[model samples]
Target chain A: MHIVVCIKQVPDSAQIRVHPVTNTIMRQGVPAIVNPYDLYSLEEALRLKDRYGGRVTVLSMGPPQAETALRKAISFGADEAILVTDRAFAGSDTLATSYALASAIRQIEKDIPVDLVFAGKQTIDGDTAQVGPGIAKRLDMRLLTYISKIRELDALHGTITVERRAEGGVQVLKTKLPCLVTVLEGTNEMRFATMNNMFRAARYPLKVWNKESAGIEDLTKIGLKGSPTIVSKVFAPSPKAVKAEIIDTESNQPKDLVVTLLAKLFTKKPDLAHDIAKNAP
Target chain B: MSETTEPRKPARKKVELDPKLARYKGVWVFVEHERGQVHPVSWELMGEGRKLADKLGVELAGVVMGAPGEDTRTFCHQAMHHGADLCYLIADEVLRDYRNEPFTKGMTDLVNTWQPEILLIGATTLGRDLAGSVATTLKTGLTADCTELAIDMENRSLAATRPTFGGSLLCTIVTLNYRPQMATVRPRVMAMPKRDESRTGRIVEHPLGMIETAIITKVLEYIPDNLQGKPQLAFADIIVSGGRGMKKQENFQRIWDLAKVLGAEVGATRPIVQAGWVEADRQVGQSGKTVRPKLYIAAGISGAIQHRVGMEDSDVIIAINSDPNAPIFDFATYGIVGNAMVIVPALTDAFRQHLSTSRMAG
Candidate 1:
């Protein structure tokens, strides 16, 4: 089984802060990490390789710096890593990004037949969850998204069954091989890197491909020109004019504070108290 | 240096749609249903679609796909009650359950045949899965988890506004050249519309051409989630949520205590859930449940945009955090700048007493 997992490098969103006055992203010192969600997909692919005795290839598309993310994937035991980067790929949205990645996957297939493609459910930055399906459509591959567990994988029969999260229940779905899957988060724990794998990751010669090498022939469909959605404006969320009314007490005792708060709350909205009383079991 | 003085025009060119796409009309909402019941978000989108349709001077329609039954037709009438001017219905045995291949083909086929200008779907698991594949098959654009949807009358396009950069900033996106511009909005983000029983609409039937044998993916079984102890945060009248500041898993109990006193549901931020402080289902944020409780008390939550977008629409917000500068203070209706450990218990006791007294008085 040859599995290709797509990962992305994104700024650590938890530590990201917005400028107070400017309302712009304050990204100066924020570190970049492989999109957290992608780690689940990478780990799942590694697990599949572990069980099937096959190779796992990690793929990513971004600036040259994205090679770091691919290397990080190698540290988790991926057999190969490919970074598709080019100046023409700048300003691509989900549509164009999938086009470039799909083209690169087609190129990768020429070297080794890929049985499965794995991707994070969505990126923390873009959060569109569109590229995986977009690529599946372009490749004419079966797309299985929000997968929770791999119940069965009959490589010999070219069939797979898995639990897919749906609106109200989990749908146990069976599909053919050579499918593209977007794995949901919390499905598995990512394995820690071993010393031997760390050394191998550091020494691995990463493969870098640009638009032409990636087999992208249409210049209009590989970048901003190919992106159908245009971001017209980016602005800060307008602050609510009414600041929260701070509840204070001179006594500074929890009990006293509670008493005062309850008194004030009931005085202001008697209906709330009545509703709570009525609904109480 | 001698340079041609025509100020370098903005490098980006204004997008012009192919003349073929100009005929697409009407705003359509995908009426999502499960187990014979329609999701309320479908109605919310219907109400929102009504506004967009009115602005563009076009009809608002609902698209319902389900098994052949009266239940499917009833959903069409409900969609009209919520504001749909018409509905497109597709019924087939293959669509009895939510399988991506069949639903995507049905939806894409409907779009190709009926050519709606805009398509709205709830950002649920089923809707997201279907929307992505449908948009890809049509070679169009889709914006997910939109906070606002409006018609750009000047361009006759849908401007989908959503939080970007992890909800720190808001960006308005336009599918300038794509017909059937698509977007998904989280459930509870929009207000539920008044159901008008007097309203009526037309139902145009479509057929699902594919059969069960053609779809490679087959549903073997469906195990419903155990709802015994599940929290209904989306429709809760009151909610109390905790975050990383809760310090430990044990500390989350205080949030539950407060919620129990008020007959409310308990919610947590994503990090807290990821840390194993709480179950994943209790999480409330962009990646979790979007809630619109009547009163939401956020305890120890710093109010990141991801969490805010999920619960900011609550009728009233009360924030309790030790840090005075927590972002929750910006939008909360009331701020209690104190340790949640100290304040949550107090609020719980207070509510207990207050509720008992009210019961006695009544």
Candidate 2:
């Protein structure tokens, strides 16, 4: 019943800013936090470990400083930590990312066979929501994304039932063990780390794996070259020179403004006026 | 359980098992079908994928799975009309119902054998479920919920741009090394291409290959979704949408009141929708429905990128939120920085008094 929680170190969204001139994000000096979504995954893994009596391993792929995220994972009750870091692994997209991770998980398997893998539904930094599925795919495991609940878990039987939020409603799906679960946000409230756990995390000796150590054989397949898609450019969303026209909040009363707005609005969209009149309060 | 002190396993290098994934060619879009009808998002992806294929100079194709001769091919022809150069139709009895195992295998087998250069699917229930399994089986890169896709001129590759960081920023991802760079686009991101009835494409039929017995999961019954009273936001002309600025879940009732008066679909920001105050289907954001309402009244929604991506294309956007600096104001056609709780009802009252009275007077 050993569990693995995969997390990413992301620039805090609140502090993220796009370079006005470059139209690219200004990443410098932005403090990194555990991707908000990944926290839910970590919390879920911890809850499972507490109930199942198994050790939890926190793993991350980032630069050396990203060890902080792994340490933070330890503070939240992960028993072991692994940081897959290398200059080569930089710029890896979901595809290259999954390749590196699958190798590391296999390496971790030698230490302890991972029964369950937990990840955030999607990283704020990479909203593609592909990595979890990619990792699950590479590992040949079942993937459960947008999961609202883990209705039941029969660890002994290697069966898990969960509710996945679809477009219109939810679908209750069942899958066997060795599955990757990407948790939806707001699924559970994260608990505060105890002082003991915090101290343990701060001092924990993390295992840092380079590309070779991570079991990535083909150097070309683990980074930018491995990626088939390339970002030719990124620009800020085209902004309207004039923001939304201000409907005077003060001079014109709400009721009066409503009249002018309706007059102007209906002149433009006559059908809307008719539609509103047809469905009166 | 005690922590195991087992030593790590030595690395085993296998060349044959991990050989360069080869022979896979072409670009395919999964024509997502559910409840006997195909989702429009599938067509949208085909149009988008058509551009990506043309850039790579690859043939654009559609992979469809459904009951034998059950309008699936006609739907494939429709896809060809939209943009597909070829349609890979897999008609099987097992595929009539949208079960995971059969569709996953059917699509995966087609992919493994054909080795499409790129595979696109709509980010729908059937798409996501099937994409996850197929991508996993093929062990390739799969991007989801992309706002933009392009062929990187430098490499002639697919450049998938999506909102990263919960819509706070955007990231461009490439599956440079993987064949069939996989991605799923949310519906409405791409404009549905004009269909040409006269346009024709070759049809290559592929068998489901795997039998029903080979699949582990079985769909006992579909319980077709109850659509009788569903809100049709995508097709709505006038929409009264609410966001977190409404401050309280109960305040959404005001939006409902206004929408009821306008006969408009009620929409909400991703946050409010996720808050359980409304249905997820009513969510209008990057990960939700991209709307084109004729007249849109947004109550209390600050335009986050997530919400903006969905509603920005509206014919008219009128924002009403208490915060003057709310981002929704930036793109709205008009703005009123006052309590939606108060502003909405006032607007509602004003609309009722004017529209009803005008009707009576006329």
Candidate 3:
């Protein structure tokens, strides 16, 4: 079984800061890590490989620097890493990105038939959660998303069953192989890299593919040309008209603050006090 | 690679869309329903879609696909009451429960036959799963989790505004030349339109062309979430949420203590949820639940734009953080700069006593 996990290199969103004066993203110091959500998928893939005795290939699409992310995946026991990077791939939206990645996966399938594909539920940067399904549709694969648990994998019968999180219930779904699964976050803890695996990752030669190498035949279906969505405007959200009213007291004691806060809140919005009381246990 | 030019920077250039795409004429909202209950996000999208439709001088329509039953028909009427000028109803057994195969086929076929200039869907799990597949099958552009949707009059396209880079910045996206300019808006992002019981509209019936035999995937079982007593943060009127500054898991109990006293739901920031201090369902943020409660008391939250977007619409925001410079104070209605550990308990006690005293007086 060849399980290909799609990962992304994104700026550590938690650490990203916006320049106060300019209101522009301060990307200079932001470190790029493998999209945190993708780690769960990668870990799940690694576990599957350990059990099934097959190869776990990690795939990513980004700039050249994305190689570091794939190497990190390698250190965590991914058998192979492929980076699909190209200048033409810049400004690719979810649709264009999925098209390019699907083409690359098809290319990978030429060497080894892929039985299953894994992807993060969503990327932190885009937060779209569309690319996984887009890839599944492009590849004509069964798309299983928000999977909480992979209950069974029947290689002999060529099927898999998993628990998928829906709105208010968990749906136990059984589907054919050659399917794509996007695992929910916190599905499993990512394993720490071993020293020997770290050495292997450091020395491992990575496969770097541009558009042509990734088997992207249609030029229009890549990068800016292929992207139908255009950013008409980018701006910062306007701050609220009023700043918060700081509740101050003589002693600056917690009790004093609470008393002032409650008094002020009730005096101004009496309805709120009534509402709270109505809901009180 | 060179930096990509901003699409707006080329303001002087004229964009000629494909003539074939120009024929798409109406606005469609996919009304998602499950077990006879329609998701509220569907109504929210319908409300947004009405404005877009009126702006575009087109009819607003809802697309409802499910089993051929009273429930499907009931959803159509609800859609009309919620501002849809018409609803495209596709009823079939295969679509009773959402199976990607038949539903995607039904949606894409409807789009192909009766081309809509714009399509809106709720950004729920079911809608996202369907929209992505349908958009791909049709090769159309789809923007997800849009906070704002409007019509750009120049070329008459859908402008989808959403938080980017984890909510630090907002970007307006437009599907310049794609027919059925598709977008998904999360629940609570848009105001719920007041329903008109007397409102009426047209219902166009469509058929699901596929059968269950053709579908590869099967739903083995559905274990309903035992939500008898779970956090319903999305609809909670009063929410008391904790953040990273809560220190640790033990400290989270204080948040619950306050919530219990006030009958407020307990919420957590994404970090706290990720750290296993709270369930993911209790998380309130850009990636979690978007809540617009009457009062939101945030303790120890630094108010990153992510967590801010989810709760910013609350009628009143009370931020409690030790750091005076915490961003939460910037927009909160009331700011208390003190250790959340102390302030949370004090607030709980104060509210408990205050409410009891008020009850006696009344």
- Largest TM-score belongs to which candidate? 3
**C-alpha lDDT score of every prediction, in listed order:** 0.86, 0.76, 0.90
Cα TM-score per model: 0.95, 0.83, 0.96
- Over B302-329, each residue of candidate 1 has an lDDT whose tens digit, in order, gives 9988898889898778888999988899
lDDT of 1: 0.86
Q: What is candidate 2's CA lDDT for residue A251? A: 61
Q: Write the per-residue lDDT of candidate 2 for residues B264-357, one digit (tens) a residue.
A: 8899887787689998779887656888777889988878776888878787888887888887888998887777888899888877777778
Can you list each candidate's DockQ? 0.54, 0.22, 0.63
- 1 against 3, candidate with superior lDDT: 3
- Residue B135 alpha-carbon offset, candidate 1, angstroms: 1.3
In candidate 1 the C-alpha lDDT for residue A83 amounts to: 92
Please give the lDDT score at residue B335 for candidate 1.
81
Q: How close is candidate 3 to the true structure, as a TM-score?
A: 0.96
lDDT of 2 by residue, A73-181 (tens): 9898889999999888766766678778888998999888988899887766555566777787678777777877887789888888887765555667777788888
Query: What tens-digit string does per-residue lDDT give for candidate 3 at A40-133?
Result: 9999999888888899999999999999999999999999999999999988888898999999999999999999999999898888888999
